[model samples]
Target: MIKIVSFVMLIVVMLQGFTLESDYNRAHQKAMQSDKIFIIFLTEKECVACNKELMKIMNAKNVSSLIEKNAIFVVVYKEQKNTFPIEMLYTTQYPTLFFLDKNELFSCKALRGNIQPKELMNCLKLR
Candidate 1:
């Protein structure tokens, strides 16, 4: 009985993690409707650094909570370039992070390359 209860609790906790939308248009729409910022994460499937950075972001509790409360998070892979914006094409780095304000404009400088959880929190506070 305890094991079953623990499993259920685990599932619930896992479900509380940040949700990454794949479609930029849909995510932007939702963000505008909610009056929240839009956060775009550009990554590549075969990039080890990107995967590691993503894992750090997801595992950071504070970062997850801040993102959930104030932003619409979206992940666009290299294979899904069609979903990305032309403005973002200038970036060739993996695991790039962009924060768009409520007006759908960039809130701050784009973060490229490897980023730690604390660095991510600092970036969020910038906007």
Candidate 2:
């Protein structure tokens, strides 16, 4: 029983470790290679609204699939200044979205609030 419990615990820890790091630099590189870009900024560790918005977007299926097919998704934690991969795209808002092209062309604003997944998909699919 002890061995079995230990093995199960090990598996759980390993699985947890595989979660996405959301590193701006790595995500940006992936985005630059892709056809579209989806970048989001959350204020900091203490913002509940920001956390909820991030959770909603990250777990959103339509958003995730669209991102997988057409865009690269990035999450920026605002309190951490130097971690942002690109300095030119800074914002004062807690939750702001920057839609871009493969060449880093800033396109649209998909800010956090009450946006729905279908609406987001439709917006992204548009030219």
Candidate 3:
């Protein structure tokens, strides 16, 4: 029982590690240190369909081999606008993917709205 409990907890933490960061500064710092592109995913709190589509992409097979390794990611909701930098606080849609490098912070706006998993994977390759 003890071994089983420990295994389950380990699995939970490992899964959580793959999820996008909720803090912009931390993700940006990570990007700088790891030489990874920084991507900010913006969504409104009530956007269900958009969130599902994003989940499909993030939870796709070979996830750890792709986006997780290539980018330092953060997700920002409309309600959390005050938490991010003023320049990063704006978005044109309910869901948007903003890709930025350390040299050019918050400058690149990628996708808007629900995106397919294949599309996101393709975009990842170009970055």
Candidate 4:
């Protein structure tokens, strides 16, 4: 019984918290239709702190509320073989966030490295 409980708890923990689609095409399509912006989050496998910080900011109520309403959050790993188009996502940073217009054609300067929740919220409000 204890083992079963532990397994169930593990499953619940694994499924908890935030996640995003890594597919840019799908995100772009949705963005075009919904008048949403694209938050192309370029992450790296070994950047543990960066990943944690992103999760924290994304999970924060203010940041998430603004983002969830205005953007199609697409997560792409920098070190992996990317499935998304690289034209707009081109960047060298390990954990960079590229915010694009609804057309997914133009992007402001990429937000690189650790970013605060308020900073992200302010950016989201611009779109």
- Write down the lDDT of every candidate, Cα atoms only: 0.76, 0.56, 0.66, 0.67
Find the 10 residues in a row with the least total lDDT in model 4: 10-19
lDDT tens digits by residue: candidate 3, 1-127:
5346335534543574554677777888888898887777777765766666556555576643576778776777768644565664556676777778875464444677776656666666766
Ranking by TM-score: 1, 4, 3, 2
Q: Which prediction has the highest TM-score against the true structure?
A: 1
Query: Candidate 3: TM-score?
Result: 0.72
Please list the residue runs of candidate 2 whose C-alpha ends up more than 4 Å from where it truly belongs after superposition.
1-21, 83-90
Q: Write the residue-wise lDDT of candidate 2 on 1-127 in tens digits.
A: 5346335534543343312325666766776655456454444556666656655655676666665666665555665565553633455556666666665566665555555667667757863
lDDT for 112 (candidate 1): 84
Per-prediction CA RMSD (Å): 6.4, 7.6, 6.2, 6.1
Lowest lDDT 10-residue stretch of candidate 3: 5-14
TM-score of 2: 0.64
Instruction: Give the clashing pairs for model 3.
Output: none
Error of 3 at 98 (Å): 1.2
Reference-based lDDT, residue 11, model 2: 53
lDDT of 1 at 57: 73
Local error of candidate 4 at 119, Å?
1.9
**Which portions of model 1 show Cα errors greater than 4 Å?**
1-16
For residues 1-127, write the lDDT of model 4, one tens digit per residue. 5346335433432344323655777888888998988888777665676666666665587776677688877766665564665663467666777888876665555677787776677778877
Candidate 4 vs. truth: CA RMSD? Answer: 6.1
